[model samples]
Target: MTSRASRSGRWMERLNGEIEWHPSQAVTTMTDQAHSVASKLEQLLKAVANNPSLERQLKMATTASAICEVASSAGIELRPADVVKHYANRLLSASDEVSVQNFDLCSWDAGELLWAMKQWT
Candidate 1:
């Protein structure tokens, strides 16, 4: 899992409070709007979980835009950037060192969101 760990190392470092934000770099904070989007994301995922057809559609979605379309059809407002920030907030809000270590790698991979969603099934 070296590649997985390496790919997610930035989140790991941020969890440990090791990252110092520079003005030029983008930082994701848990703003109210972001939280709202994250909640919408949760709503979309839950809808998919409860609907077999939706789950299948979501599983077949190959890109963030496709996923958003699926979510939109479910009446949930979500975006790719929202998905990215969702994981960032999750990593940033880790309650303990162990939880940080146990952070789900698949959840952090932007390209593997469909895979991650399936894993939750």
Candidate 2:
């Protein structure tokens, strides 16, 4: 009886040890996907800024799409025109108008805040 109990305990321990434990793979995958999307968005924004035609069309397309995604993530539903208006208003706020550095800085700060919030919460 003692040997039988000991053998059963060993088997149980082996079974438990063989089992793998991970909190949530889905959460990890989602975070990875979000990071990939953000990286691609930044790359696209840079591409748009480097060329006038790309900039115009991207402003009319990619920029609006990206803003929509951001707005959706932030629980806001905004039109492209509204975004453009807000952007124009920001442009007006600058005494010397706007520069590419300002554009990069804006997105960089936004991304920083976003990642920070994710980490904090």
Among these predicted structures, which one has the highest lDDT?
1
Question: 19-86, model 2: which lDDT tens digit per residue?
Answer: 78545877787567555545555655565566676565545544666665544543445455655555
- Candidate 1 on 31-90: residue-level lDDT in tens? 666778878878988999899988999999876788888999899877887776666667
Q: lDDT per prediction?
A: 0.76, 0.61
Clashes of each: 0, 0
Candidate 2 Cα misplacement greater than 4 A, ranges? 1-23, 62-121
Ten residues in a row with the worst lDDT in model 1?
Answer: 21-30
